[model samples]
Target: MATLPPGPVRLYGPQFEKDPGALYAEIRRQHGPVAPVLLEGEVPAWFVCGYREVHQVTTDSQLFARDTRRWNAWSQVPQDWPLAAYVVHNPSVMFTEGTEHRRRAGAISDALDAVDQFELSTQCERIADQLIDEFAGTGEADLMAQYAERIPLRAAVAMCGMPTADMPGMVRDLGLSIDSSGQESLDAYGRVQQAMARLVADKRVAPGPDVPSRLLQHPSGLTDDEIVLDLLVVMAAAHQPTTYWIGNTIRLMLTDVRFATTLSGGRASVGQALNEVLWQDTPTQNFIGRFATRDTRLGGQRIRTGDLLVLGLAAANNDPHVRKDAGGAVGNRAQMSFGHGEHGCPYPAPELAEVIARTSIEVLLDRLPDLMLAVPAESLTWRPSIWMRGLTSLPVRFTAV
Candidate 1:
């Protein structure tokens, strides 16, 4: 169990970015299910692409743990590594194990569970309507920048009871934290931590009806510091991924005639489009993922203790064996988009995201029934991060009314 040779398909570069789906299929064909992969900086890791292999790795938490400190490639990773903030171990629920993880995660679930779904959807509709009004009279809009990217952050900060005044800055900082690298990325992460810390402190002194307030009052006795960290996790989880889900769903609805022609009234179509995006263009395509606890073999690949395994979530969804058995992607909630097993997206989180995304799309279509792509679908470009699958912009036009 020593360092192996670098992978053939470098998971970066323009070629891979331009056509990642093709590269993923090629990797699967050439390297089998659990193939060797090179992360940024030519770091070696395992990419678990097969549906079954991903299932096994996720299900066996002991064998494949969430802790990143156990990763053996740290020696090879550079200090300036942009992704360092993501994998850095903290006392937050993300890096915790066993009882500790359950305690923290349970508090989160309870807090999220207390949210009234009926009210949440109503709130989402308001957020969506407000966003749409900004561009409704313009006759054309870049939905990604103007519409899709704005909704999730606004709704989430409102739900968390943060000041409306802080939102524009929060949106910018959160974007950098997710998309930036090097010192800039670290700076953005620090700013987010500071902001959440202030929120947690304020909530401790004066509580209210919001996620952070609930965490402050929960019986789990989360520390101010712990609440601060977990709040960052929850917000980051809630924001960018949910944003892309909205954007990707809209892109799907506008471009695909199958969806476009069917929307006399598209509550059902909205749900179908949302689910289908989870299968094809998952917001989080590849995850930083679990570390090997000990020596093991997965999908015939020899894995050393402390080796890193990047979960090829989107790839696994398109796995031929599973897709063949399941017939097709439509109506298949079985996809690993939100992930699976113990440390997955944690119950109420996924449900809330669906509420936000569904309402966002449904409202947009209602307000603009004639919504159609402003440019050829081929001209739409995806953002170039291997970890995220999202359009750079989705231009659309409708009658100004």
Candidate 2:
């Protein structure tokens, strides 16, 4: 740790719960774009916060790579580190580099591309209606638990050819994998990997239109093991962020002055609100990140070979350098919410996430024209995790039809 900068700002704790944007601004002011910081276990890392610095790191895959095997601090890390599971190296597309990355990422991209957006939207509508029906008659509901949380995960499972019965288990395990670390994360990952292996086995016998089946039959000729791991990456990437996208966008339309006024006629502004959320309260805040392949200077800090650099994604989106000319992200699409360059959320994935999020809000607005937040916005709280941004619950009320 002595090799890194001194007096590193600890990135964990309650200060982030109130206003993480404020903390990011402070970090940038004191330490510049790339600041010294500590993770869950006082683990030292460089937090990449500047708009251009993030772009520089993510785009230069050769210099800042995803493979955790190159991390030099492994010897100093404790066996019980809470964040250990977040950086575990696996053979999946997430850790693969070079030609192997191209093949695995290509197969995932091709499989996801084959999903007809129109069909995906139609399925989302049905899922939204079904979920709404469950709570509509009650006259009041926690939208986070009742509506926002359900729609995206179901679509993810269905399109991946996973059985409807498996949805409950996948949801439980996936939540643990992101929110918890240590053995809990390891256990949750194991369960999902097993479920994916089963899905791959089924698809091996009978190919279908879902992601798993498509990955199985992809011309790239993926092995069963490869299909299982990559499917894990695909499902994990799609499930959490997309779920929070739907939730956070709904929160914006309900609380913010700009979009709340259009509650009854909401479709026109849904796209704008979605973009605004990406620039403001991005769902995945900190990506546990890249390792330096060789010593380099970034944001005026000396980055050593094998040093860990966490991407402060939400901070990058809020960088004054970028926002000064953005004129507010109402319709601007330049935010790094989906990341950038080769390791960015692959093509069509972000587009498809928009399809799901947009249709979901449109359907809810159409169903409950008089929707209202049940409590003051100040009383609402965010889930406490440095990695992901989401609400504990969004309580709302409306007249039953």
Candidate 3:
């Protein structure tokens, strides 16, 4: 109904990747709550950044639907568009609504609820210790690759009833499956599917006290295809966000003098440090895509039916309207890092993610008290992805113990 802004900001490219927060601030100043942006491959969508607006969009699933089948872009844009990798239609709860969403989400929640939080924490600590031991003798290691990535993957796979021997190949394939380009990613996805299929078969023959077994016994009676997709969701959800959460919080402690002083001096707990990171550098920067069910207006912007809209969780968390003092964000658990409303992440609930991150980081820090960045904070590079914000590497030197 209104003329779209001229030359809408392109979400991809080096400048945006390097410093997205600056761009988000500019967008807020110029476009208010919502702005038109081009995702990878020039895919256009609405990016909702205002705190209130994001809350509304996420909670009011009736008006703003999660089913991408309602997406107009799917018909207009080529199927191979880079953003398609993220927005592509899937059979999981993430792409469903109404009763279907409840049914699928219920199964996932039940499975996750069966997880022993104490055991999970113990498992994470064990994995963290083993990973730390791998590089403990070296005195220097890339924490991102060595610690942050391994802990979550090991824990997630174990929870899924996957074999420890399959972890290396599965992790490798999962990494490739998330890659943004090339035929290797497609091949990797195939491998992941095959591996997961095997896992499902194994669980069916001899069920265990794991997520897959729980999902199998759920009332929904999810099919094998549905089971595999849901398992992939759990694995990916557990690995990516948890990895970033652990790494970002640790980075904050290592780089920010105030946090380091407070943490080392026992003035602040690991939970406080993690809450600050959740508010500031949220793991998944932008998530929960919803397609407009009909022509609508939000934050003074017009939206046509089937238009794709993404929640800018990171930007909304930083919105001055909701978060005024960035320095005082410690213990601010109100941030939308874990998301809001119905389509939010079910596994590793907000408190659980925080505990896992805190325990993992504490174990590493305790084992390597002298751990510090090997390079300046500014020198570190972030992984380039429109959906996630994560460090590519965190090279740190620590005293061998």
Candidate 4:
């Protein structure tokens, strides 16, 4: 008879659920790298915090399964809902394991490699110029509402070959999905379901030269639904977090003078600045969850079967044990900002670096060139979710340049 693995850990509660990073940091400080917690009754899980261990565990697919069957068994929602069943269920390159996952991920990886940073740089400059033109003289604008969010959202949508007519509603729906209200979130999920279904159907007839089309033509023979859901997953994953990162990056740079000067120098300088931003304030702060298909030992702890292994990638990035320059300025890109292993984010980091640097500089270099915070640093509202770390709103004042 096989030995059963450990039970699920109750890591998520209303308080920790609301603001997990703060609590997660505390837990790491008290315990070493790994700690056990009970979640949802008696389900025991080990929250992996050590950078090296998290990296190792995530890389070891055989030990810790990335199979959806294991995940669905541990998920919060029932399997019946399309949002639960299809959106998260549809096998994408991101969530699978072993040979199959590698095959699907290869397509995306190849596409990302082929992405031209020069072309992307041109687009970034064009979009930045246009957006800046709109708010050129206007001293006041919601950066998040107007530019930061829309740029990446538009890019991701275009990358998928989705119609522009559908973008506004799609962005709205996906945005609401991340908001606090439960009813609103469900409603947003429904809209996502409807939008993806329609888009997939249209693409099936007339596929374009985009990620979705590539997935459709993939050797894995992904169904229309799978292609659409996977694309949606990509869209949903990239949009808000990238936007938030851009905002946070800009805000942080504006505050730190020496850092700001280094960033303003040129392209290579900008790349280093981007790396610093990713390490300092990683947008996706949450421990993207995984389920243990079988018994496994991680970080000196026994992980039992059916247990939820929460890998706190954010905490690991900030771990004193790993970060070389704990007190100094952002030094090197030694963080898991894009995650690790087979499921690592495949977007061209250089393209993103260009986009963020160009857009942010365009805005602040002129009108808000010396933009200073209107609110106290501590008073700024931090997003409470464990999944992300950013200001909900950051008010700043600057003389019209």
lDDT of 3 by residue, 121-230 (tens): 89888888888888899899999988887777777787787888998899888877865358898898889999998898888889999988888888898887899988
* lDDT, each prediction: 0.85, 0.87, 0.82, 0.65
Better of 2 and 3 by TM-score: 2
Q: Itemize residue pairs with steric clashes in candidate 3.
A: none
User: What does candidate 2's lDDT look like per residue over 1-401, in tens digits?
Assistant: 11223479889877667677788998888888999998877888999999899999999999999999999999778888867767889788888888888888888889999999999999999999999999899889998888877777777887887777887898788778766676898799889888888888988898887888888888899999998877777777887798889889988999988887888999889998898889899998989899999999999999999999999999999898888766565468888889987788988899999999999999999999899899998888888788889898999999987
Poorly placed runs, candidate 1 (over 4 Å): 1-8, 181-188, 325-328
lDDT of 4 by residue, 196-266 (tens): 88877777789777666666666777777666656666776677677877777767666666566754443
Candidate 2 Cα deviation (angstroms), residue 55:
0.3
Model 4: weakest 10-residue lDDT segment is: 1-10
Question: Which candidate comes out best when scored by lDDT?
Answer: 2
TM-score for candidate 3: 0.94
Q: What TM-score, to 2 decimals, does candidate 1 have?
A: 0.94
User: In candidate 3, where is summed lDDT lowest over 10 consecutive residues?
Assistant: 1-10
RMSD of 4: 5.7
RMSD to native, candidate 2: 3.0
Score candidate 2 by lDDT: 0.87
Error of 1 at 49 (Å): 0.2
